[model samples]
Target chain A: MNYRIWEGKSGDSLNSENQKCTSRCGMTSSRPGMARRSFLRGTAAGIGGMAAMAAALSPLRELEAGAFNSVEEMLQKHYKEMTPDDMERALARIRRQVEQRYHVRPEIRDIKPVEGVEFAYALNLSRCIGCRKCVHACVAENNQSREPEIQYIRVLEMPRGTLNIEQGNHHYDRPTVPDDKHFYLPVQCHQCANPPCVKVCPVEATWKEPDGIVVVDYDWCIGCRYCEAACPYWARRFNFATPKIPKGALNPNMAYLSNRPRPRGVMEKCHFCLHRTRQGLMPACEEVCPTGARKFGNVLDPRSPVSEILRTKRVFVLKEDAGTLPRFFYYFDERYPRNTGGEAPTWTGPEEFPHG
Target chain B: MGMILAGLSAIMPNLDSSRQNEFDGAQPGLEELAHPHAEPVDPHIPGGALWAMVGFAALAFYFVSQPALPEMPLAATPVVQASEIAPGKRRDPIKEPPRIRVGAFTYGCNECHSLFLSAPERQGPLAQHTHIKLDHGLNARCFNCHDRFDREKLVLRDGSLIGYDQVPTLCSQCHGTTFRDWERGMHGKDLGSWDLSSPRHVRLECHECHDPHAPAYPPIVPLPAPNTMRMGTPVHLAHEHKPEAGNPLAPWWMHVAGGDGAAHGPGDAHEQTTHHTDGKTESAPSTHKEGGGQ
Candidate 1:
């Protein structure tokens, strides 16, 4: 039985049979020879596997070393796990990277959420002129890729007489906006309370902060694009190729979870300008809106603009049927479209057009 | 001197003939100019030489008489203050109140209006304030907003005068709903900070965004449309769906029939029913109906 076992293990039946009597049960002299033969065979298989692995990774050699992440970045912890010291180190590394690439030493910080502050956005549908200024302002603020343009906002020109978004045209090219026959509706990340994008993330690379901003950990994301697919608003943008931005156009103010220059194959979206908003500044889109259509503020305080809007205005969210419960809302003012020949009352004199 | 004189003399005959041809009105024939021998030679300190000397003298006199270029001043490098360069600090977008330019000087509305007496009745088409197009949808009278006696102040419904900064209060008399929204920072633009506790919070005045005389917003040229569609096609060209066809994403009722040259879908009957219902409701929010008198 011992002799048969030794022969089976060695796969050398004829030789094993010749030495079986000595090697198997009692003799120790034949043991060294059998061990040497098995060790040589194992080494050959191990070498073959290593060669295959090296060949498989050969394409990575073409990647530019400077553009790729350093050893420190590759091993950096997730945003939630990083301590203050780790964050400082990460920010320093980011600053160095940005300075080296964009020639601007960005004031990058890992801005923490303020206590008791929850940000929400409200847009006036009646006032939005379909100008697309908000969209461009967002791109400039977020340091989005220019050529392959990753804009957070998509303004749709919906024909009058319907609230249906499907009936909206995203690519409306008109001489002027707010066409007599059409109204504009701009769509962006709703920052949902029950964000499906966060739920579907396999690695938990994205999460909602205490302040209600859904942010992505660009370093931790594996670029699987599950979150992009799960998002109903199509807000998440996947960097298909290396993002290109002019050095002069890059916004020097950056944050780890918000508008930092993202590497290729990472997911990014509107963090509601968390870098600026956390510092109590208005979002870029809201600031650039010419018609005063965009409004953003803390929803926690009763006196906050968003809170007032919610309390007073008949606000509605896009894709409400999806049960997203978005922080962003859309509302309308009570007024006729200007210059529409609506039967405005006639004014005889100052008596009729009273001081009021 | 001799060589110079000889060169000037050689060029003189042609110049004289050309000048005479231009100014004297008796033009020389091309054949006479081409064949110099066809014309008699007259050389009395030729008219061309005199003119050339005059031109040279004028050129020399102009250069000598001109003032020397002032020493180029060093580029005025702006001295940036520390507070100006401080991080997170932004300059205010509106630095000063609106002023009326009268002749060479800019003056506040009260400066000139204070000198004149208040008109008893609504005056005819204004001669001075002609630029103020009163097209604010029936709220057209000047005294409707301006105080009759106090030119600097805005008049309210209660016949009380308020300062220029209080335009919102004056606007609120008629635009109650909009003013209510503006009070909460919902209607007009709010800058600086969303946090109420922050010292930087600023709500813009009504007159900042809208013209007082013509409250209705004017049409402005929109920014260029997005050109980042898939397959590298521009947005406008990529989706060239005809406007008459209505939006492709539109519901069957919203879509115009006979677009794309195809027969109507099975929802044709349902489309007609919904279309009639939709016509009555319209797309406007219910608030427009409730708050109608704006």
Candidate 2:
């Protein structure tokens, strides 16, 4: 296995077996007794300093020098054991890689682990038009695995001319639209004000903050999926296997709010596009909306657009009797046209019945 | 002569006083008193009996303006439980019993009706028609005849009533059209369902179905559809029965027949009694020992 002795020797003098062995382990057969002092000295110094010098001068593992450094770093910290400093360094390195690869100077924001904010979300079902844009956008933004394709958002195609939530299906195929007999309702996490997910978390790894945002510390999570079940809205999802994202396609503009490169066996959900919203910008869905249905603003600010809509418009929260006090509100229209594809008959009456 | 002069002076002053009394005592002209009944009297009487009567009348009028105690009943009925009810028992169909006289409705029809005085059953004469011709004899009362209603003003405990412009929710108690619609979220008004440009929706009345007195599910459809009540079925409950993911304890109940794990069951949990690969019928677990827990 020792190929250091042959490292300086002519290639013709060395056997192919020894060459292969040297290449595999990057170890060379040399006078170990003579190099013992030098190796110890190198070890006393940091590994990176040695790596930098090795990359330039060492003939051994020149092609693998970069890969080895990264692999070594990856093995150093099990995600759970990583410290805040380690995360920052890891994020910085990722940033460099993404900038080099994609030519995208991503606005990477290290979301401060808010001390007391619980993050949640609510979809205005009355506003959704069964557009699959949110679904596709989530797939592209989250960098989901191929095969049985995955995305966080599932724009359910609800029955038209009816507001029956039961008739909606998320397992819709291509050409996804509201069923002719059903009205389109896009559903996502209700992000309940009282999150059962936080209550059921075995380790206080996931918690709600003062800002009403619920978050999970990925490193602290044991992947029990207890939070997922405790959630009535089915907002939480668990990563059963290691996530695969093509390095080139990875979104470098990651925020703790919107998209953070998640580890395996952890739970995740919509952060209300926090990465964008916290920066005083609209969410990706609102930015990309075709119907101008989605509205996002602070409910506390009375003058804000969301608050104004709530004040003047006949807005109602879903399942208010449940006492969840959801922030998302909906405005019903009376003159909405019926999509008559399904068997459910549209009953036309006085101009008072609201279209859902 | 001196005595006569002193008497004349005293008489002159007495004469002026007498003249003033005569003028005041004389019957007042029409210009002084507008009417003879407007008799002059002492102005210092405190609240007299007449004043007390007027104050009492004013107080009574204010009290009369507001209706006596809320006429609508506030008690909630014990939730009707379906799970405990036996399947085949033909319970009486929920209907408001007929009220012929003062105490005809004894079976708590007012539990749902709330307001007692103008029960929907007393609107029309039931003596002339049969139960079949009268649509189960439901159209007998005041609420039965009156259709639209408003919840803000309810029928009073006394005979006095207010006109309800919007539909009364009385129909919802029996018809369940609006209740079913509400469960599916079709009946009620909300902004989220409508376009903002034209934003007006209907306010449905409960009397839209039941004759308020009879309060029956309108026999509008030919037959009620069969109930399909499967738990965890996609229609009723989708993706809800999934076992906790990656739980090792899950594998115990799902082990294959004869302890062979290869021929697995579907959906991450299996119920297999025989191994098909080798056509071996696995010996059943002793029903007596395993089935009954000590």
Measured against the true structure, the TM-scores of the candidates, in listed sequence, are 0.66, 0.39
**Residues B9-57, candidate 2, lDDT per residue (tens digit)?**
3343344344443332122222123333444321111223224334544
The global Cα lDDT (0 to 1) of model 2 is 0.42
Model 2 residue B165 lDDT? Answer: 40
User: lDDT values of the candidates?
Assistant: 0.67, 0.42
Q: Which candidate has the top score in lDDT?
A: 1
Q: Distance (Å) between predicted and true CA of B40, model 2?
A: 99
DockQ of each: 0.11, 0.00
Candidate 2 residue A23 Cα shift, in angstroms, is 65
Interface RMSD of each: 37.2, 48.7
- What is candidate 2's CAPRI-style docking category based on DockQ? incorrect
**Candidate 1 error regions (>4 Å):** A1-62, A336-356, B1-124, B230-294
Q: Which 10-residue window of candidate 2 chain B scores lowest in summed lDDT? A: B285-294
